[model samples]
Target: MKGIIFSEFLNLVEDTFGLEICQKMLDENQSDGVYTSVGTYDHRDLVKLIVTLSQLTGVDAEELQRVYGKSIFIRLYQSMPGLQGQAHSTFEFVKSVEEYIHIEVKKLYQNANPPKFTFVSEKKAQLIMDYHSARCMSHVCFGLLQGCADHFNEQMDIDMQPLDDDGTEVRFTLNII
Candidate 1:
């Protein structure tokens, strides 16, 4: 059994669900000033916590299962409606994660040599598409522009133009930051 800090577990839970839900769960599940332990920090307990977090957050179980592969973080975030909307497209979800990481890294190295990160290469783009198809099964292409924005640290705005028949053209513009 790995001796993980309680704060780390809480961070995972908060990442999955927002802070509000995490607090609520803690309040509801706390028994005599201690939250129930799963004995060992295995997959089973993670799954249960995901379910509970999902219930608290109002996310669909099927959707969470599809994207996160029983990941506690994914399950908890998938449970929340707001966060689930954020995960509408796999591209967008991945982009969000990448963006969060990039922002943090940039902040950490603002005064030093800020390592320049490359945009998602063609190979990575294809992999992301494949993963989206396998996990999200969503027809909507989201996050491609957002990912680029994060890579370049630029603001982006997506404009949807309706095309003839039943298609739409999405135009992404990099706004001056």
Candidate 2:
């Protein structure tokens, strides 16, 4: 996983659960909790932090992942200038995840294992995406969609379809309602 992910996750933990819990998590967990945006580490480290936060806050791991995904999107949006203005709507933004954002990510980090999103369909008010990622972070993707809705000040109706037992493949149908 990318270092920015860990850093942002730590920041999210600190922001959501106060610095004390964040510190305690770092103090007790295997991770050193010192992540640099440009470094890379084991995905387990990230999972460890998430699991710790979930235990501390009594939130389900999946729910925390979703919220973390949403929080990460805010950081992503703030870091990448004009990303919000480029998309006229949340559907367009979600559709652009693989085509645009991942492309740019590859330009910066060729080895980065970002998720693959295939455009499935689109209608007047809905868009469908087929997602595949070994990371099994579909809930995070869900949160990103939710965050996009918030970014555009729009509401979204989203349906999740899991295609495998591991949840590596998921279909997300987003409605701008």
Candidate 3:
């Protein structure tokens, strides 16, 4: 994972919770709490932070991940003005994730491992997106989809179905409402 993710997560924690909670989480986490935007760290370190935040705030880890995903989406969208210009709708934006955004991510972070997405179907008002990744962060993907809807000012209904026992594979059904 990139350090910017960690930095943003810390920012989210501090903004949502408080400075003390964020500092306590950092103190409890194994990492030294120093992150540069260009650096890379273990993805598990982020998992730990989210889990710790969940424990402290009494929020579900999955929900936290979803909210974190939304935060990430907002940040990414703001930083990449070209992406904004290229995508006119939420569906168009999400469909470009695998081929476009991930490529850009790889260019920026050579070691970054991004999830794979396949569109099962694309209709006039609905899209089915299949997600595959070893990290099992489908909720984050869900949040990203929600963020897309928000960005496009569209009302969307999303349903997630796990393809396997583990969350490494998921099918997301999105409907514009």
Candidate lDDT scores, in order, read 0.39, 0.85, 0.88
Q: List the candidate 2 regions with Cα displacement exceeding 4 Å.
A: 82-84
Count clashing residue pairs in model 2: 0
What ranking of all candidate models by lDDT puts the best one first? 3, 2, 1
- Model 2 scores worst on lDDT over the 10 consecutive residues at 91-100
TM-score of each: 0.28, 0.93, 0.95
lDDT by residue for model 1 over 1-177, one digit each (tens)? 111313344565678777777777666654122333322233334345446666887876444442342233333343334444554443454455445544653464453221122332323223221111211212122333344334444454433232223322222222333
Among these predicted structures, which one has the highest lDDT?
Answer: 3
Write out the backbone clash pairs for model 3. Answer: none
Candidate 3 on 11-111: residue-level lDDT in tens?
98999999999988888885568899778888888889989989988999999999988878888788777786788888889988887988999997788
Q: Candidate 1, 82: how far from true, in Å?
A: 35
Judging by TM-score against the true structure, name the best candidate. Answer: 3
TM-score of 2: 0.93
The full ranking of all candidates by TM-score, starting with the best, is: 3, 2, 1
Which wins on TM-score, candidate 1 or candidate 3? Answer: 3
TM-score, structure 3 vs. true: 0.95
lDDT of 2 by residue, 81-176 (tens): 857678888877776777788889888888888899888888988888888999888998898888888988898898999989999999999987
- Which of candidates 1 and 3 reaches a greater lDDT? 3
Over 4 Å off in model 3, which ranges?
none
